[model samples]
Each structure stands twice: as C-alpha cells, then as structure tokens.
Target: MVETGTGTLPTYTETLPRIPESARTARRLVDLALTVWDMNEVRDAAEMVVSELLANAVHHARCESVRLTVTRLSDSRVQVSVVDRSRAHPRRRAAGSMEESGRGLGIVNALAHGRWGVDSLAWGKRVWADLEVTSGE
Candidate 1:
C-alpha cells in the first residue's frame, strides 16, 4: 500500500488484478483504512462502495489490473476510488425486477448518498464514491 497525504489526511492505494476476487481485497483495504482512521462508522458503506466500483472495472474494463484508492477527505468523510484503463464512462440504467445485474451503480448511489462520480483520465477513468461518517464515530 502507498500512503500519501497533506498533514492529517491520509490516502491508501493498492493495485489489484482486474478479477472478481479483487473485490474482496478491495473491501479489506477499505475496512483497514477506515478502522485505522477510527472511521468505523462508514466502513461498511465504504466497503460496499469499493466492491461495486471494483466490480464495474472487472466486468467492464479491458485493463489487466486496477488501482484502488481510499482517501480520508475529512474527519467525517472518506473517498473510495478505482482507476482502470477504460475510457467508457458508467451509465445508470433501470433494471428489470428479474435482472440480477445493472444494480451495482444504484447500490453505490444509495450508499454514497448520490455522492459518486467518474473522473476521466488521459489513459482511462476513475470511478469514486464518497462516504460520510456519522456522528459519534
């Protein structure tokens, strides 16, 4: 993991293969970062957000691997991001009742409270979600 930040805010980053199993590792990274920062209040949400982000990359991106970054934005907020070599941005689509897929972004949207978006990079794109830690965390 690479740790970098300005003063108190810390960011943790890891590069993982673009495979389904990588989502588990991504979630673990999220859990560890939030736990160490004493931001357990948002750990679960962060984990889910990371999982969905990584899943999107694994299923859609043609890259061999993806970079996951969990950054502490503030005392009560954290941002989870996945960078992949796919320029195709994500789109929100309505899923049928029997559909098993197409709900990942929706889940991320709800978990992040609509605080998620994609950043287009020169080589690819970055999908990120911001989770706000509740009070008393």
Candidate 2:
C-alpha cells in the first residue's frame, strides 16, 4: 500500500445530541472506508469510535449541538474528530457501583493504536485522535 498524506478529508459527520439521527452520518464513514479498508473489523472500529466520541460529546459537552467528523490520514491511520461548543474536556471516571456510563475515551484509547487528545479550537473545542488501520487491498 502506498502511504500518501492527502491532508484531512472527512469521511462522516453527525450531531452528538441526536444519537439516532447522527447515526446516519456515521454510515458515511463506512462508505469512505470501503475504498481503503475492505475488512469489516477495521472499518467497524473506526465507525464505532466515531459514534462513541460523538455520543460522548452530547452526553458530556454542554453544547447546543456537536459535529462529528472522520478523516483518513497517512501511515494507514484514520482520525475521528468531534467538535462541540463546549469548554469541558473529555474525562474518564473510575467505574463505580454499577455505573452505566463512563469509559468512552478509554475504550477508544484502548482500541485505537495511536494518540488521542482534547484541544481548544477557534470556535469551541475539538476532541480528535488517530486510529492506526490495516489495509489489505
């Protein structure tokens, strides 16, 4: 496979607040992956992370609305980025007694094979990270 950096091209987008509606956007990321990742495992990983991040934003970030984007990068890596009109960063809490939530980023960090972080953007803030993917085509 040839390694080419084509900047950042979003594969999908969604609103975190509206989980179901936002899910439709996540499907587009799968379509983008078809051209790169032919395997279901690799593509699903990216899509799942995209959903988790966006959902997290809606659950945590106090934003009117959130935007989710996924971009394919070089070195067989794909970035799942979420932007929200929020100042609070992504946080992980220790799982307490029958806690129903938490562990989103941790799951993402564990599944992904690269770096992830939260940063301040011009408008609000963007939580983005890279997931190293395998290509067999």
Best candidate, lDDT: 1
List the candidate 1 regions with Cα displacement exceeding 4 Å.
Answer: 6-8
Tens-digit per-residue lDDT, 1-137, candidate 1: 77888675799999999999999999998898988899999988888889889999999999899999999998899999999999999998899999988999999999988999999999999999999977654
Candidate 2 residue-wise lDDT, 20-83, digit = tens: 4665566565446545544344566667777677777767666567776666665477677789
> Of the candidates shown, which would achieve the greatest TM-score relative to the real structure?
1
**Residue pairs of candidate 1 with colliding backbone atoms:** none
lDDT of 1 at 73: 91
- State the displacement of the C-alpha of residue 93, model 1, in Å, after optimal TM-score superposition: 1.0
